[model samples]
Target: QSEIPMQKPFQQVKELVMEYPVSENEPTEENSYLSYNLVVGDSLDVEKCTAFEVLDYVLLSEPGAPLKQALLDAGLGKDILGSYEDGIYQPFFSIVAKNARPEDKDRFVDLIKETLEKIVKEGIDQKAVAAGINYMEFRFREADFSSFPKGLMYGIDVFDSWLYDEGRPFDHLKKLGIFDKLKKEAKTGYFENLIEEYFLNNTHGSVVVVNPKRGLAAQREKELEEKLAAYKASLSPKEQEKLVKDTVHLKEYQDSPESQEALNTIPLLKREDISRKAGRLYNTEKHCQDTLILHHDLDTNGIGYLELLFDTKQVPERLVPYMGILKSVLGYVDTENFTYGELSNEINSRSGGIYFGVQVFGNAWDNKKTVHMLGIKAKALYQDIPFVFRMIKEILGTSRLGDEKRLYEIIARMKSRQQMSMASAGHSTAVMRALSYFSETACFQEKVAGIDFYRLLDDLEKNFQERKEGLIAALKELIHYIFRPENLMVSYTSDEAGYHGLEGEIRELKAGLCTEEIQGEPAVSVFEVKNEGFQTSGQVQYVAAAGNFAEAGYHYTGALRILKVMLSYEYLWMNIRVKGGAYGCMSSFRRNGDSFLVSYRDPNLRKTLEVFQKTGDFIRSFQADEREMTKYIIGTISELDTPLTPSAKGSMSLNAWFSQVKEEDLQQEREQILDAGPQDIRNLAELVDAVMKQNRFCVIGSEEKLQQEKELFQEMKYLL
Candidate 1:
């Protein structure tokens, strides 16, 4: 090394800054625009930071790209480019990154071309594209997006309108024609746009300058924070302008007759034919007078009631109090007579039963009847419907924070889950929408006077403390009026033949391919053992194995999963499945269910000798792990703690209710998995061993799989 310090050893440092004109002066036809999009795949190596690397690769690959850097650098002091999932059928990559460089901009165009070429040459998997499309279709088919609240749609639409006005490229969104197609098909991919737009912050992408070294990240963070602070400080002028406009809006609304008339009217939940009803307008002193009667019948227990809604277009300002009272009285779910639980049970039990829910819609001041499509299903075991209803009514009619304790509990659980692993994208979106609605629903504010809403809440809360019986009587009376025997109906089956035992509950007698569970069949006797020490004690047969492929085609983890599920199933029904104690004992694979296990429906318990003999063959007949297992471990960890959607939420709730598992217990079990290691799985497999031996298994099989194994059953019975 030369002694540069001795001579004139000083390395001059300077920021290499580049500038480009905002527009390339590209000529364009009127009403025409240019758009470009970028998608990057993610790898599951948590230590690898594929997401970070991809962004860095983008920046390093295209030096002197200010537009790109701006989007990536936006996470100044935040968690930056949050959690990402790996190896899901859905697109694991993001289309959040976008730019509006003109089509004719040579440099920008050349840059995209270069990058796309490199990506393909590096081996872009066509399978990924097909997987993405299939995932989208499956998601659309399974998802219940209609459950999303209208308020959310309204808010998102307003937000989008603002973005449109600001001239942002919505490349993540399908093209106008494509968007319509997706909307019509109800493609799950349609949601991908919103997921990317909101979750990925695709609308306003980040730009980061990538230097191949790690040390620069700290310096970059500091510099980025200062820059963003300065930019935010500069927005004061625009904010002030917005404030003035809002004030003007308030004044204009105050003087509007429609607003005044809406304020006077008290809204009610109509329980008859709302569609055929019409709105009648009248001239009055307070402002205007109108009667818009609405009725929608939801029958429960052969009862129906008529809901007469009279919206007064004119009245004294004090009339708002009366409106408030009406809302408080009418809003509680099942508060009218029976709780929602009672209604659901009565209806489902009777045959095909229905339940009614009501809502008011419109703007913040005066709005119109917008309640026709709101459906509420309250679970008795998992949710307190009456309490939830009270909370909802209280929030809508009175305070902003109804059920504050419950909300905090829910948010805390969600936040913890997010910190643990990458949550399922679909589930996360669903949860946020649901919770946000419950947290900030003001659907009734516009249709009725805001004052009325507040007054009704106060009246309900006050009356509950004073004349509780009278209030209950009023609610029951309302319920009686709506759920009268004449108003509702359901089909009933009185024949005992239709009521089968638990084993015969799931039958496919009418189907082309049918399976049946015969009586007195030899089963593994895998029944739940209650009063057990464990919090969760239900016995389940593991029936399949599917593994994540790692390192090209290696399936080590997949093999382990297959072995575990298979062994458990076979061990339980040794004589029952293989030795002909029962028919068709085998394990299968389900790609979507995220599990690999063995299962047996029918087990020949009587043939314990042959069953024991078959276990050795089952164990010896399997292949060893053929691929890297670490990837499967990582993927499993990522999904186990994912957030809940209505579907997931409902499923989890039902599981807990039926299995007698508490939410807290599940959380504890998850937390126990501090880090997914081989030992964790080994222990889980061992547990399966204990469970298979003790529980009774159900048999759903063919007589053929069992007839020949009668000797095994006889031997086991003789030994016993």
Candidate 2:
């Protein structure tokens, strides 16, 4: 069956390598995407499937994708992409040459084939393969999908076993087991053979060419109908009858509902098992070498988690943009001790990972104040703390900031990624833009990681040659200013054994850091919002309106979280998505009194804003039955109890301390969420109304849509 999978289709095809070109893209899409995909193997073969995943990481990921690099050198496309996809009944492999022309179709196919053949003849990089294995192994141990519900993510991982092979629901639950065997097989010829057997020799595949288009979906649908009709006509009468029956059964299954008895089989958390009090972090603050240190003694399986947060107050306003740029390039450029790739490999081999980012810790009780800092987070085995600290010192304190070419490459990549993510994350971008009008906390966020940062990246990418020397100079000076002993604060999470060696390492880390003291007050970056609209090439608009309730004399409450659930799942869902034809909408009320009501992929901009404006009315008149209230309280609790890694816990504690979110506040909020009533939500309606009345808004949509609502915005321009 496997040998002849594509034989029937092959009979009607004009070529073994088929090309089905479609002259269209998503509605109003500004750019075209090119993809090359083929069915390789399935999840049923665990060893081979896992090997393909590792191979994809080595050959297709950033920091280097050698095969994709070859394609880029050939000028076939602007970006090269390839990957192995599993966790399904029939998994496939895909290689895309972004921005490549239709004529380069054959060139892409040929290049992929030749590359595989060359690698098969020669050998793959053992070190890279090991790094790939280590990478996934560490992630498996971490078991942290901080962005999503842990149980839901686990279900996603386990579905392959339960859905595909119900005989063993927990078949794929053991990920590390697969990795252990894979590590041994990788050092042999198993991966190469797997590649040849699935990718090189597999013929059950098709080529798809997608051309850019706007407002041509109807034409594409009609073409699909004609082709489908022709294909159906080729079938025998009995075969066609079976196809019709099968389709009817499929639809019936999709519409089917489980019986109440079957539903009762699912487990529920009893009230007795639930914790009444909130979880408290293990934070023991002290001082060492004139640096503030917060230690979290937690079980980490011999792993040490350390966070270095240096206050950004000393950074001059002029250096803000450069400091943001430094976050993207540090730990990713050539250091005096190691090249970026080598350093990455070494880090993976010995430790979990070393990373950098900018953080804004706004006091939950006071929006008027914030703790802005540059953060470096590292995790490694207790045995390897010395190596991790050395690596951190090298990258954060002495990275080669003068390499213009490498810096340009990093910024360009950053620009590409930011642009790609902007399409789906426009709602978030809009919120940041809207809140920057008044909220200093949002101002700092937007400067480092939001629209302001994107603008900086855009300007730099377009004119890097002219901006190179000065930008590098500013980054160098800012890095020095940031890594000083005075600004550095540390947080470490580990067993006592991990801390046993941390004191000496902390001293060494501090000694290597800059000791300069500024003579005067530290400068701050000030930002002003334009109340602008960003015109994009999207079919729908991301409409957002935000304001801080603190200005309205309102404070944060646990009831706000319950209201969040109701609005997100009920009010906004019904008004914006179900009735208004938008994809989704949500509202957020943070402890700092910042709030935003936003719609995702909304069609009518004016209508969405009107819906947002009426949200307070919804909450004021809101009523929930006992069952519904219980469900919402449970939902809020679910969010509050997200599974956090040890490292993540340490980071959270550090941020909480800086933000003034104390243990009593957390426990009080938990109790409030648990015992919340309809009145609790209703009482906040006045605050919501006052916040919405501020009328600070931002919209990111197609140029046509933005033009239609042009009166709403003070100014509008192209987002990218």
Candidate 3:
């Protein structure tokens, strides 16, 4: 054997850099909006710039800051105000303003440039920096680590640090010191120096503008098809045969069963690692006057999470469209004693966030009963509890909805956001629309966020000048029904001391709201939802099929959940993603016994649907041995043990209490999950077969694909 010459790490890195030369500007006219990105040459090393990044976020776009206000005034309010992307070789700053009116693009760019020059000359306000530091500190301490495995988070940190040649990965102690140092530096004008040196002085930069042109998506699809056809024609018959063989071999390997001895070698948490005891439930309910209070005491490190749920039973159905917009517009507009800017700054300084939204949950005792709530959710420091309560009162009691110019601006901005969401999250949109046909909760959700909601927003945006009076009246009516004391349910999560300290203040706040009883039975209206496929100009496809098993008097078992995991990870992944080239595919089982199969960023709608239909057969034929069952059981239990933030824990407890999901029920579910065998998976295939027989589905995809499979859908609609 001959020894090969080895290259040093630096040489290897240099060679790699030379292989992929950075492009100054990649031109594109494919987008439906005018998108701009201004990139700077200088690198902001991650280890050093983390604090400055946080500080800069506050000054440039912190809700009601001057820069953001300037953009809003310029009709660029929907733009992504300020965001930075760090790179290893050369980091760059980005100021993106997308979906801008063609006529306003020039002015928008000029405004952004002017704002940057002013910041460079005058420096940021010290008060803003201080508040930003406080907010950032709170966020760092309350970081949510429940979505993924803790070990995965740690691994990612380590890998990034190693790749960037930065310092060691951060831990709780290390982060505290880092935040303290950053705050001290921010107060000393360190961010101003960064602005002048890295941004103002750096001449090496590029301005990329993506302008929209009609039929762009269609043209691109045609070009792609032609290119693929040419490539296939160029390939030799032997090469094509080999490619097919390779694909089949790969699928075989993915579906192969592992032996018990082989599985034992892989690293995993054993059964002993799981705690047999159920999660701690910490909610205590009390009544103050007519208002209901759900409180939880947890170690929150001197932070408080307060959420208010106002019953929306008395809200008239006519005002539903206006109620949909209330959450976005409420805290963002002027109040009686404060301008919108002042209110934004006040809330940012005292709390993590103060947001309002609509929430719906099924009643525990009667699944047919739907609880529609308008929720005001907020989080604050223990000392700022009084201010949080006061602000909530002001927002509910004194918010002015009559500012015509401001209201129009808010609606326009909301329309822009919804359009963007429709493009990127079409899969979720399709699933919501499909599920809406079968379940009450799903129907309400669709009315609020689905295609119907998008249509309502579009009409308001296009005909605002004509519909102004009706819109304002509807908003005012919504406020009247949703802000009464009789409809209030308050829930708070904090340390024991924080809860006791704020109890009196909360009671006083509740007493000030209207005491008139909301006299009505909950609104119940049956809707005849059309089974439809929606068309969009998106490049990819999203397909969803959902069925309501509960309504059919069938309930989900632990075996069905296990079958879902197997189908999603093994069968669907292999067929829809690996072979068919979708980005992702999943089968989800909801607590309400509703199941949905969704394909994300898929290329083929008809093929993906075929794959979904085959799931029942796949599950029926699955022959997992003892080791495979153990592996899946362990994986499921690991998810159950995932840690949640104190605030999240409190919310989960409250939801469980309200839903009457007792500890025994959860324990039994866990047992069923662990005790599930291969036979159970085969039995659950019957449920999958039954669900597929309904022949109900909704797809959001390219118009070309929708037209090709028009007969598969009962009705077809265009999203944009």
- TM agreement with the true structure for every prediction: 0.21, 0.85, 0.88
Model 1, span 404-435: residue lDDT tens:
22222222222223322211121122122211
Give Cα-based local distance difference scores for all models: 0.29, 0.77, 0.71
In model 2, pairs of residues that clash are none
lDDT of 3 by residue, 277-344 (tens): 66667778876766777888898888888988888888776666566798888998899987876777
For every model in order, what is the number of clashing pairs?
Answer: 62, 0, 0
lDDT of 2 by residue, 1-720 (tens): 123232232322123222222222222231334566666666666666677778887777745556766776676765666777786667778887665576677887788888888887787767778888898788778776765767888888777656666665666667778888888887787777876876677766766666555434334446888999999999999999999999888667644656657756866654335688898977898788688889988888888888888888878777766677888788878888878767777777777788888888888877768888888888777888899988888886668888876686677667667766777799988998898787778887777777778888878866988988888888878867788878888889987777887878888888888876653346554555577888865668899999889888888889999888888988888789867789989899988788999999998799988988998898899786555567688888988888787767877887788887889999999989888888898998899998899888999987667878898888988786
- lDDT of model number 3: 0.71
Model 2: CA > 4 A from native: 1-32, 74-78, 99-115, 147-151, 175-177, 206-209, 213-275, 516-529, 624-628
List the candidate 3 regions with Cα displacement exceeding 4 Å. Answer: 1-48, 76-80, 87-89, 102-106, 120-123, 149-151, 154-161, 166-193, 236-264, 267-275, 364-367, 515-522
**Count of backbone collisions within predicted model 1:** 62
